[model samples]
Target: MTKTAIVTGGGRGIGQAIVERLLQDGMNVVTCGRGAEPADLPEGAVWVQADVVTKDGIDAIMKAAGRVDVLVNNAGVQVEKSVADSTDADYDLVMDVNCRGVFNMCRAVLPQMSETGGSTVNIGSISGMVSDPSMALYNASKAFVHGLTRSIAVDHGPKVRCNAIRPGWIMTAMAEDGFALANDPKAAMADALARHPVGRFGEPGDIAKIVSWLASDEAPYVTGECITVDGGMTAASPLNPGLF
Candidate 1:
């Protein structure tokens, strides 16, 4: 029988890739995002219009699509602000969407998962383990995802297994635009490649494959683990900050 998976932020970027992957794997995928739904979603993929930061939205999604075997908490936004520039509103916005959003999804879904004992992969970031300039809020938010994964694995074990995947710089539309706006996008991307031990940046497929493996019996022994799939960038950190 096919499985059921719910992935937030599935409208675009890494989340969209993951949603497509799960559908290709012959599972039912329920995806949600803020405001609009993807027009080109997979035939088997269900798109729900919802805001992850609110409890009512979370409830609506979970109630409409029941029994999820895999829950990917992939909805998040990065706030580029230094300590001096950050305000209370900025901090609240970051935590509310990235951290609290994950919590609400888990709470909405965990009861069903606890009984069935499935898998959950939280899309954390390498920033969760490390840090970057002007990204303290995003970094901290990802750290919360890692901590939350550990908590779920510990509390719901023998039934549910929770793991986190910390991704490096992934090539996506938003990232592409950001790089371009930063001046000399290709050079910037190339510079990043030089610093990374693997000598290249990552793609969405890189993360999607790892996530699929973690959710399968192939990684049965894995739980409460924060796996970094950054192409060896996290392997050594005497690396460059200019490209980060």
Candidate 2:
């Protein structure tokens, strides 16, 4: 029997990569995003147009994908604001999509998953582990995801496996916008690269490959872990240029 997988926010970026990789693995892939399907979405995967921020949206996903063998909670939003400048609306938007969205998806899918044994891979961030300037709400929301990942693994283990992947700085559309906002995009890119020991930013396929492996039977014993897929960014010391 072919397994089924659902990846949220899969129209582009890391989500799209995960969807494509899963399709290559021969799993039945279903992807969803808030808006219309992008032209770049992989051909074989099914596209379900829905947002992860609301119960109805997740329910729509469950209705379209029955008996999900794998669930990838990849939908997220980032609000670049300081703790003092952040507003309730900012918190609401970030938390609704990043934290509550994952919770709702797991709540909806775990029962069926428990019956047959499945994997839940949440796309977390390095922000959850470390703080950055003007990213208070975004950092906090990802922390919620990390903590929730552990709790779910503890609560539903031996049947449903739950884990998270913390991607460092993938070259996604969001990261490009961040780079373009800088005063000197070239210099900014160089500075970002220097921070990682690999001397390069991650590609979406870097994350997609790990997600595919985690969802496979080969990783049956792995659960409740937040794997960091950064190019040694977190491992390198900011003050030690020689470390790299």
Candidate 3:
């Protein structure tokens, strides 16, 4: 029988790539987001309009997709502000979508997944492992994701496997916009590219391929791991290009 997979925030970016990749892998994919399903979503995938931050939304997704064999928690938000400039509202919004949402989805799906073995792939970020300026809350939220992923692996192991993917500087719409907003878009982009030994930013497909592997039978022994898919951005220091 074909496995069933659910991908949150599948309307665009890495989530959409993951949905498409899973469909290519022959799994029945169910995608959810706060808005209507995008026209570009893969033809074979099912679209559920829901928000990950709310229990009602998560329930709606679970109700639409019964008995999930794989769950990809790709829904998240980012706020660019230092702690002094950040507001309580900013903290709440980021945490609600990034941390609480993951918790809610995992909680709702684990019981059903425990019945039969399954996997969960969370889309964390390199920001969780290292600090970045003007993104304090976003960093903290993803750190929570990494910690939660490990905890879930420990708690639900031998039945349900859990892991996280830490991507760096993916060329998504949000990332492009962030680049465009920089004082010198071209210079900023070039500097960012120089940090990665691969000489380019990551593509969504890079993350999708890893997610596919982690959820497959081939990765049965893999759990509680935070795999980095950053094109070597975090592997070395940006200041010491000669060291690499």
How would you encode candidate 2's per-residue C-alpha lDDT over 7-34 as one tens digit per residue? 9999889999999999999999989998
Quote the lDDT for 214 in model 1.
84
Q: Runs in model 2 with CA error above 4 Å?
A: 180-183, 240-244
> Please, what is the whole-model Cα lDDT of each candidate in the order they appear?
0.85, 0.90, 0.91
**Residues 67-164, model 3: lDDT tens digits:** 79999999999887889999989989999999999999999999988888899999999999897667899899999999999999999988999999
Between the candidate structures 2 and 3, which one is better when assessed by lDDT?
3
TM-score of each: 0.92, 0.95, 0.96
Best by lDDT: 3
- Screening candidate 2 with a backbone cut-off below 3 angstroms (N, C-alpha, C), the clashing residue pairs are none
RMSD score of candidate 2 (Å): 1.6
Runs in model 1 deviating more than 4 A are 174-187, 237-244
Which pairs of residues collide in candidate 3? none
lDDT of 2 at 164: 98
Give the TM-score (vs. native) of candidate 3.
0.96
Candidate 1 residue 53 Cα shift, in angstroms, is: 1.6
N/CA/C clash count, model 2: 0
lDDT of 3 at 193: 83
**Candidate 1 per-residue C-alpha lDDT over 105-191 given as tens digits, one digit per residue, 9 for 90 to 100:** 888888998898789999999889888666889889999999999999999997899999999888877456446644576887777
Q: What 10-residue stretch in candidate 1 is worst by lDDT?
A: 174-183
